[model samples]
Target chain A: DVKVTQSSRYLVKRTGEKVFLECVQDMDHENMFWYRQDPGLGLRLIYFSYDVKMKEKGDIPEGYSVSREKKERFSLILESASTNQTSMYLCASTVAGQGAWTPLHFGNGTRLTVT
Target chain B: DQQVKQNSPSLSVQEGRISILNCDYTNSMFDYFLWYKKYPAEGPTFLISISSIKDKNEDGRFTVFLNKSAKHLSLHIVPSQPGDSAVYFCAARGLNAGNMLTFGGGTRLMVKP
Candidate 1:
């Protein structure tokens, strides 16, 4: 079984503070993703890394960035956390497999609250 | 533009009844579709998937039906259990798109005992 673990289940930060969310996967998947879930908005991609040191901006990457220094770890960084940035963040990994189809294994998610 | 759409925001079903969740996509290039279940405070978990070539795929009590012509798909859960209550998200991936997925807004399923 594949396991994806997030650094925190809940977090609280003041406005303009820097925040980091960490994720680690045991499957050594090549693709890692960060997403934020909001009511009525679904899960919007924030950033994704296809390989170590390679990152791409997803649909909503503003005010957020990601790091993939190693194959097993991915981190999401908020430059300046704002109240609007409060959300449930999810990390997922997908193994490179046949035919462009790979099931994403996801972590439990971190709910961040900015005050 | 929202490529994937789930029109219904929520659905309620009696225990042991069938629960159907629908999803539509505007992108015709998507060849892979998936269903994920998410509980509060948890990330979405992969449930089942179907390829564009096949119209139907089933696993246990979950069945996914796809209509290529309409660019739509549906998930049917037989004998819905209370544990099935959660937000269900539909995701799609285009050919050669790697593992990136476009997801629907999701529909909350509530099962009554």
Candidate 2:
């Protein structure tokens, strides 16, 4: 089985604070993604990394950025957190290509509260 | 524009009944569709998927039906159990989208015992 681990389950930060959410996948998948879940909005992609040191913006990536310094680890960074950024963040990884034929293994998720 | 849509925000069904969740997409380029189940605090987990080549795919109590012309798909869960209560998200993948998946707003399904 593939395992994806997020560093934090819950976090609270004041406005304008820098926040970092970490994720690690044991499967060594080449693709990693960051998504935020909000009621009535479902899950929206923040950023995705296809390889180490390569990143692409998703539908909503204005306030967030990502890092993929290593194959197993992907980090989501909020350069300056805002209340609007408070939401459940999810990290997922999958093998390259194959699309829906390949399932994305996800972490439990990190609930960030920006106050 | 919202490419994928789950218009129904919630659904309730009694145990042993069939629960149906619907999803629609506007992008005709999408050839693959998937359903994911998520609990309150957990991330969405892959449920079932159907390719455009097939109209229906079944696994156990879960079956997915796709209509290419309508650009719609439905997931049916028979003998619904309480454990099946969760938010169900519909996702679609276009050939050009690579690993990126377009997700719908999601529908919350509650099963009562």
Candidate 3:
């Protein structure tokens, strides 16, 4: 089974602090994504990387940046954590062209709280 | 603007009964639709999906129905069990959307025995 792992299951950060969320996939999938699940808002994409060193912004990417220097790893960075930034973060991976038809394999998710 | 929407915030059903969850989308660009189930503290998992070309797809007790003209879809679970209790999210993607799937607000389904 494809496994997408997130570095943290729970995290607490202070406002204005820099935060990094890490994700790693073992299936060697070419597409990786970061999304935040908020109440009433659903899962909104933050960023996605289709290849090493390549990144693209999604629906909600204002307070976030991502890095994919390594194919198996994708990192989401919060420039400065804010109270509103606290949310459940999910990482997912899928084979490139099969995205539209195939379902994404997702990690357990990281719950972050900013105070 | 929310492209995909699940108007029901929650639904309750009894075990062995039919549980129907609904979803609607405003964008005609959406060509494929999917249902995802999520438990607390866990990421959502793909439940069932239906392509625009077809109106229905079934897998075991789960079935998905899509109406292209109305831009609406529904998931049906027959013989619903307590294990089926979770938040059901409606998601969609355009043909060329890549790996991005737009998700709805989600409907929490509780199956009581």
Best by TM-score: 3
Reference-based lDDT, each prediction: 0.94, 0.93, 0.93
Distance from true location, Cα of A72 in model 1, Å = 1.0
TM-score of chain B of each: 0.99, 0.98, 0.98
Error of 2 at A58 (Å): 0.7
Residue A54, candidate 3: Cα error in Å is: 0.5
lDDT of predicted model 1: 0.94
- Name the runs in model 1 displaced over 4 angstroms: A97-100
Question: If ranked by lDDT, best first, what sequence of candidates would result?
Answer: 1, 3, 2
Ten consecutive residues with minimal summed lDDT in candidate 3 chain B?
B92-101
Model 3 pairs in collision: none
- Higher-scoring candidate on lDDT, 1 or 2: 1
Candidates 1 onward: DockQ, in order: 0.69, 0.68, 0.70
**Residue B111 CA displacement from its true place in model 3, Å:** 0.2
User: Model 2: per-residue lDDT, tens digit, A39-85?
Assistant: 87888999999999999999999989899999999999999999999
Q: After superposition, how far is residue B95 of candidate 2 from its true place, in Å?
A: 1.1
Q: For model 2, how does the per-residue alpha-carbon lDDT over B1-113 read when each residue is reduced to its tens digit? A: 88999999999999999999999999988878999999887878999988889999999999999999998999999989999999999999887677788899999999999
Which 10 consecutive residues of model 2 chain A have the lowest summed lDDT? A97-106
> Which residue pairs clash in candidate 1?
none
